[model samples]
Target: MDYIQPFNRILLVGCNECVTVCSAGGRKEVGLLSSALQSAFLSAGKSIDIKEHTLERQCDPEYVEELVGMMDGVDAVVSMACGCGVQEVARRYKNKPVFPAVNTKFMGASERQGVWAERCQGCGNCLLGITGGICPIARCSKQLMNGPCGGSTNGKCEISKEVDCAWQLIWDRLKMLGQEERYLDIIPAKDWRTAGGGGPRKIVREDLAG
Candidate 1:
């Protein structure tokens, strides 16, 4: 709200991808935000024109190009998708201002109804095979690869009692699979370059491009 000043006419673009499944930036959320913003402007003695639309996937250029015609009446756009979606929209329409309405939290899973938990960090490495399917990079508070940190207590992490000790779960899973010997293996330090540490990353396949 504080960042949206100087723009009375705006468009709210929602994504029908991950955000839609998570109920964050779907068609339903777009409608709610549009109504709320309109009400807010009216209450402040100002009128706002809000247009709402949900793309199949905002991260794709084909979907983002749909907004070109809709941009005729709106001064700015409020994207309800994740950061990637917002960037794609901005890239498609360079002259218009774009803003994000939802904070992109993390790559997580729906633990239960109305509840989600982080699952993957996209760390550019897959240690799940050795770790017995538990990702220490995402679940461990310290992202420990070898074993549990000193802060792990009673099969729980020091960050919170609710948070399980990732290493403990890994060990248990390995034991169940009769592969506890793998636990003795020392994993080397991660090369963060593959994990997007070397600035923005890209993949180009000449065979697929043409």
Candidate 2:
């Protein structure tokens, strides 16, 4: 509310992707936010116009271009999506201000009902094939690649008792698959080039973009 309080005419955009599945930034969420904003403004004795729209995907220019017509009618955009969607909206609307309603969280998987756990750092290179499908970078507190650190106790990470040791899971999985020898083989340090150490990443598919 504080970020967008200045804008009288707001464009509330929602994404129907990861955020929707997580129940943070979907059509229903958009509606809820819109209602909340309306109620707040009404209580303040001020009226605001908020137009709601949910795109199939917000990161792509094709989906974002749908707003080209609507942009002229709105004052600013409040994107209920990951940072990527907010950035894309900002990129498309250079004249209008774009605000993010959701804090961008790490790439993760749903642990259970309303629970999500970080699962990938997107290092550009995946090592899941050797680690028994478990990501050490995301699961390990220290991001140890070779094996479990000295603090691993009873298959629990040193960071917390509830968290399972990633390397311990890997070793157990390798043993189950009769590939215990793989754990003995040490993994080398990760090259940070693919992990966005150099700069921002881009993927252009000539087959589609062309």
Candidate 3:
């Protein structure tokens, strides 16, 4: 079956927690997107049966239990949660098809209200000492460990005026902190082996595993 089609009866599910905090997908977003999709289908003379619901968290098995009876009549589920939440829902309902409504961005701390910026790449190595604490891998366009490259001009990245060169920011911060000497230190090339085999990666905590 073409499960994600507008012609089929579908459930638009949203997470009330993580996605809400991230301002990506939430109860309000669920309603907005569902209405928009329905309106679009109606405008095109195509009928769609869509129902909306918001769970405390789609990634939890307890929360997903609520969907047991609900799935019987739906053709598909459009999850408005992070990638992990979507996978959790799919794992619980193996018979049903689950589709993601939003793209998963990154693992970073929220910088401000309605703003989440990348701060770490989980590189398994900390080199903030030599880089003045600013992460060139995450903030720089080139993800250069030893950077500012030859193209940086007036503290701005050569790629775009909107982006300040990460190395420039690092240098400025280090200067303010009276740690400019750290900027002169060389950072060796990153070890990609720790990042896994350039494919799917898995972490097994023996202590936590049964």
Cα lDDT listed for each candidate: 0.92, 0.93, 0.84
Alpha-carbon deviation at 162 in model 1, angstroms: 1.5
Looking at model 3, the pairs that clash are: none
**Better candidate number, 1 or 2, judged by TM-score:** 1
Q: Score every model by TM-score.
A: 0.96, 0.95, 0.84
Preferred candidate (TM-score higher): 1 or 3: 1
- Give lDDT tens digits, candidate 1, residues 141-178: 89888999899899999999999999999999999999
Clash count, candidate 3: 0
Model 3 Cα lDDT, one tens digit per residue, 141-163: 88887658887899999998977
Weakest ten-residue segment in model 2 by summed lDDT: 201-210
- Residue runs of model 1 more than 4 Å from their true location after superposition: none
- lDDT at position 160, candidate 2: 91
Q: Which residue pairs in candidate 2 have backbone atoms (N, alpha carbon, C) closer than 3 angstroms, thus clashing?
A: none
Per-candidate count of clashing residue pairs (backbone under 3 Å): 0, 0, 0
Model 2 RMSD in Å is: 1.3
User: Which regions of candidate 3 fall more than 4 Å away from where they truly are?
Assistant: 1-3, 108-117, 196-198
